[model samples]
Target: MRTALTEMLGVEHPLVGFNRSPAVVAAVTNAGGFGVLAASMYSPTELDAQLTWIEEQVGGRPYGVDLLVPEKFAVSDPDDLVASLRAQIPAEHFAFVDALLDEYGLPAHSAPRGEEDALDEIAAAINPAGAQALLDVTFSHRIAMVANALGPPPADLVSRAHADGVVVASLVGQRKHAVRQLEAGVDVLVAQGTEAGGHTGTVATTVLTPEVVEVADGRPVLAAGGIATGAQMAAALALGAAGVWCGSVWLSSEEDITPRPVKEKFLAAGSSDTLRSRTMTGKPARQLRSAWHDAWDRPDAPAPLPLPLQPMLAGRAWNRVHAAAAEGHPGATALDTYFIGQVVGGFTELRPAAEITREMVEDCTRRLRALGELADT
Candidate 1:
């Protein structure tokens, strides 16, 4: 359990749990692992509130925040960020989304009570000016690390984090990316392969881990993708990783905030049931196959838009889908899907986040010891 990651982050286990739920983040951190909250979908105010709540729950334990600072995104008027982004979305795409919902027999979507600013929240995470505002809020907190998946952290971000004595980490799918991130002065590199949820690449973890490790020049590299158990964690360490970065596995935890309907779909799904589809984020992200994707695959379906626009369009549709599914509507239930990984097939039951964290660390230690004994024999 004593690796560079554990030592750097001052945690007992070399595990990094990435999820959006503050409760899950606090639980993982308090259970002796570093928890990183996914902050890409929240407005600056919301993120600040969530981080504040996490601090209160963890009681000074170390945790991190992950952002979606893609190097390339649709440019919009900073003065009217939400409206500019929304206007860029073609009317035809809106029609397609509406027709798809009607085809699924879903009713008009209503934001459940206080989530009226959902689209604004999504728009803020991807817009440059808005991301800067979020960063300003992030630095005002007591975060131990900051992470991004799209590419190397902006030079100013690295400078800002370094000035604050915070660790900067980036997720890489190729050796070339590792080299760039190192040059950008990132302290940690996560070798996130295609098997991971959300935005990812086509490389396999078994292959990408060592490649990134080799180019990392002694920087700590965490192996991600298809890692949900202790044996897999051990395998990552054996591949020269300092630790593991897990996201999908947390979806099965009781503390995870993913909609219960989506969790049910994840529990019933097998490894093969997931696919990399661009219909969701306009990037090849892995998610459970659903009727929404099936509809997109049809000949008449419009091609998905780019980056922020795609999510802006899909976010509205998802609100409706989730609202209907929450009411036990069969059509909405069939279309309910969320980002997940191949390890989902291994999920059999929901457990507390602390239990999951402890089990993985203990099991990994035991497995490594057993392997060492076999070698001696």
Candidate 2:
């Protein structure tokens, strides 16, 4: 409990739960672990309300916020920005999406009629502006950290967080990426492996964590990917990680707000059920293999569009899938899925978040003690 990560986040435990729902964030923090709310999908006003509510719910417990600010994307100019990028998304992709929906027997819904309009919706939701708004709200509260979900936090954002006394962190999949993040003045490094959920890289944790730690040079490193159990957590620490950044394991937790169908997929998934694909978010992200992934991978299927574009293309269909999955529709069930790591194989049952965190800590503590005894020999 007194590990470097605990000190950094001011939490009793080093277990940090990253989730989109405020309830899970509050619960994890209240349970003595750091809870980080994903702010990528929220509007400025919505994020403000969410952070305010979380502050009240956690009752002074430390929490964090995650924002998506990819340094490389189409838009660079501030003038035609969102409009220009949206126009670049070919109409063929939308036509392909429409055809896919018809083939899947899903009903059509009115989507953004124009390219610029669609990109505007995505930019409003995920751009730096969105993160800045969230930061305004997060700093208003007592959040302990502000993590960029993708690449390095923008220098200005880092300056803002530092000025506000919040630690800046970024997720990295490779040693070089870790070095880049540290050079960018990031305070914490989350070394997430290919086995991690959501957007991830190809390296496995066993190989990636130590390399990241080496590069970070004592900067706090949170090992992520294929780390669902306490033994895995212990292995991470043994590999020089300061803590574990856990995501997939919490999807089945009682406190998790993941939709029922997606939750079910996670519960039933084997470690091999997941594959990395850019079909959902235009980045290589680990997600449960489903008919959806298969369709996207089809030889004839159009390549997935870039970040905001890809999500925009699939957002309507994904929304429909979630809705139908809620209704227990079989077709929707076949399409039901979300980002999860290979560790999802170990997630066979739903447990309380607090209970899961406790068990992991206890098991890791016990295992660590055994390893310590082995050193005596």
Candidate 3:
């Protein structure tokens, strides 16, 4: 509880809850843990509105924002950005998506009709200027930390965050990546492993945490991946982590934005139910195995595209899947899946985000205490 993460963020608990929902973020921060909103999921205006609401709920309490501030991203034309990016996606991929939907007995896929397009969010994250626009919004707020979820932050971004008195953090799967982050002036390192949901590497948390800690040179390192309970948090601390950065556990929280049907699937999943596949993001991300992954695995299915292209192509299809699945469409349900980790098997019911935060901290304290007594004996 008294690690660098707590001191740096001025919170009682060193836990960091990363989620896309503003309500979850506010709840965790209010419960003494730091909550980090998934900023890249929203455009600048959306990010600004969400951050504003979080501030109102927490009343100036500390929280952070996580973003995909990749140093190297595909450059594209700024004018008509969405169309430009969509143009890069091959016609074959679109045909394949249509075929997959029909094969699953679902209606043909259609792009979401709304003011807020998921594809636009992808465009914002990959475009350098768009990412800078997000940074502009983040810096304007009273954020305690700004984490680069994808890779190392640009030098200018780091310096700007530093100038704004914001703590710069990055997620690293390997020791070399940690070194690059350190050289790039990252203030915190999240040692995420293969057991994590979303984009991850091959190493397990137990192996990668200590590896990152060894090279951290005393900077605060938060162990992530497959950590959901206090016992797990204690294990992270035992491995020399300043704290634990948790993402999957939030999916089981009531405040989580994941659809109800997907939540039901998660409750029934086991440690082995998840697999790392590139079908979602073109990068290896661990997600629950569903018909979606099955479709991608067929020999005729095209190899996954890189980064923005793959996500842009799949984003709309996911929208269709979620919308239909919510209505008890069996075909959509079969194809419905989202990023989750091995710990998802442990989820039995949804709990309030604050309760989850308090329980983890309290349990971690008790476990750490018990371990200390054993060490003394």
Candidate 4:
């Protein structure tokens, strides 16, 4: 229960749950683990509102915010970056998305929401300017930490967060990335493997964890990817992780905002039912295998566009697919998928977020003790 992560964050447990829903974040934090809210999906104003709401629910418990700050992206003038990115998306990509929707017999003729709304959607996730705005808003909050989801935190951002007495963390897929992040002055490193739900590298956790731990040079490293149970958490500790950074396990929690159709798919999925596909985000992220991936993976299908463009092209279609799936459309259901890790196979039922946190800690304690007995023998 007492690892560097727990001590550094001042939490009762070393389990850090990263989720998009404020409810789940608050629940995990209040249940004695550090909860991190993924803020890339929100605009500055929306993030402010969500963080304020989470603060009220958690009642002074420490929580963190995660932002997608990719090291490489298509460069453009900051003022017009969103518009520039939007313009770069090829017409063929849009046509491909439309064709897929049409083939499924879904409505392909929805009216445009508006140019401003479209620009906002594109900028919110991939633009550096948007991420900066979100960081400004996050610092205004009582956040305990800030994590860069894709790569090392920008140097200025790290300095700014440090000045405000907040710890900065970064997720790394490789040992070299871990060293780069530490050099960038990150306070913690999350060594995520390919089995992780969202953006990840091809390395397995079992290999990546120890490699990162060795290179970390006394800095704390959290093990991620394919970790869902207490035994796995114990294994991560045995592998030299300060703790575990878990995301996918929380998706099946009752407090999670995962769509019912997507949740059903996750619940039914086996360990192999997921795949790394660029169909969701331009980057290869692990998501439950579905017809959506099947379409994109076809040899004849056009290759996915880079970064922001790919998400921009498919974002609207995904919204429509989820809406139709909610309405009992089989085609939409077939296409519906969400980011989840390989540990999803163990998610047989929905439980409260608090209960899951407590059980994981208790189970991890028991498992570690059992291992100690084996060592004695």
Predicted structure with the largest lDDT when compared to the true one: 1
Ranking by lDDT: 1, 3, 4, 2
The lDDT, on a scale of 0 to 1, for candidate 3 is 0.89
Query: Each prediction's TM-score against the native?
Result: 0.97, 0.94, 0.96, 0.97
Error of 1 at 316 (Å): 0.6
Q: How many residue pairs clash in each candidate at the backbone level?
A: 0, 0, 0, 0
- Report the C-alpha lDDT of model 4 over 54-163, residue by residue, as the tens digit: 99999999999999887777666556765777788888888888898888878765646784465446444565666888888999999999999777777889999889
Q: Of the candidates numbered 2 and 3, which has the greater lDDT value?
A: 3
Task: Give the alpha-carbon lDDT of every model.
Answer: 0.90, 0.83, 0.89, 0.88
Cα shift from native, residue 214, model 3 (Å): 1.4
lDDT (Cα, 0-100) at 196 in candidate 4: 94
The true-versus-predicted C-alpha distance at residue 218 of model 4, in Å, is: 1.0
Which residue ranges in model 2 land beyond 4 Å of their true spot?
76-83, 110-124
Candidate 4: residue 213 Cα off by (Å) = 0.8
Model 2 Cα lDDT, one tens digit per residue, 99-207? 7767777766654556435445655356665456666767777778999877777899889889988999899988989988988899999999889999998898999
Lowest summed lDDT window (length 10), candidate 2? 115-124
Error of 3 at 132 (Å): 1.1
Candidate 1 whole-model C-alpha lDDT, 0 to 1: 0.90
Candidate 3 per-residue C-alpha lDDT over 1-377 given as tens digits, one digit per residue, 9 for 90 to 100: 69988888899898999999999999999999999998886878989999999999998889999888666666577676777777788888999998998887787655546633656555446656678888899999999999987778888988988888899999998889999999999999999988999889999999999999999999999999989999999999999999999999999999999999999999999999999999888889999999999889999999998887788778878888998999999999999999998999999999999999999999999999999999878
